[model samples]
Target: MRENLAPVSSQNMAFTDCTKPTDLSTEKKRKNWRNRIGFLLKTNSSESTLHIMKNRSCRPTADDVNQWAQSLDTLLSHKYGKAAFCVFLKSEFCEENIEFWTACEDFRTHTSHKELVSKANSMYEEFIKSEAPKEINLDFHTKNAIVQSLHEPTATSFQSAQRKVYSLMENNSYPRFIHSDLYKELCDAARREGKHIKS
Candidate 1:
């Protein structure tokens, strides 16, 4: 009878290694990196949504249709206005402003220090860094302020940049979106449906 065959210890090293104790601290680091990657992936998905919305015109409900016709402040304040404005920015190929503004809004809701830092870095790399893909037009002072705050990012790190973008949209893009055919069609539909528009 032939001797019973046995697996070599070296051959079983792979299986043994799989059962080794994992470093808890290292595991935590891995999880943090994963969260960071998730943040970036989410950002990409947002742009994808913008692309989709750009292809289709907005259809506002009765309550919001009249809100867009009001002052820019009123329009920007309402959820419907923000959505419509994003579509308008996408159409203009300048959705970065709105994206940055939205990012800022998200930052305000963060309570964890780790999450705040991670998100702030992601935003800076994506929208604030030189030659960043989504860099918005910002004044020297505003850019300088953002750069200084990166050392220890806070919720307001992007405050100056956000304000500048908001002003740009309010003064430039907001007016144009109001007159766009998309807006006109939405307004017309509301009227045909007998929706009362606020003067």
Candidate 2:
């Protein structure tokens, strides 16, 4: 039996299990969380109204898991690998980097001027402002440049900051991720998958 969990907090958002479709309070909180994350996604079902996370359970071969070790980009480009990495980051309480990074990526795909402006503003308040919730570390110059761009928001507004975050992850979290137990467990599972494939 699933129990209602205590409210969990991210850097700026609060989340709890999507208990049911009719739980207005719970639904409301989750909706806010999803909106703050800048990606409101839907799951296939009528019994749910708010869901932001995706199922990250994917079977990987040894080669697939090993490929992730090639580089941070390799891991992030693979859907499952990125999902798994998010979980790892969450465990370390440093998921904001990934969240901000992904939000910026999604920001670029928006075609509407109005939508772009709205997202850019929120992105600034959420991740770029000094001491903003979920703020990623950026140099003084980079942050200043982004603040200036907010006046006439463009698709590339977050590019420089995003690159900085990517570099930080590549040099820091990524090295630790490669050595994390989560990665090791996956590697062990993948090895079994490889052997099973042979059988």
Top-scoring candidate (lDDT): 2
Deviation in angstroms for 8 in model 1? 67
Q: How accurate is candidate 1 locally (lDDT)?
A: 0.63
Best by TM-score: 2
lDDT per residue for candidate 2 within 67-166, as digits (tens), equals 9999999999887688777866665557888999999999999988899889999998898765588766666667778878887889999999898788
Tell me the deviation in Å of residue 29 in model 2: 26
- Candidate 1 residue lDDT tens string, 76-164: 67765676666656655677878898899999899788888889889988986555798666645566677778778887888877887
Ten contiguous residues with the weakest lDDT in model 1? 1-10
Candidate 1 stretches with Cα past 4 Å from truth are 1-59, 194-199
Residue 33 shift from truth in candidate 1, angstroms: 37
Model 1: per-residue Cα lDDT at residue 61? 56
Overall lDDT per candidate, in order of appearance: 0.63, 0.68
Clashing pairs in 2: none
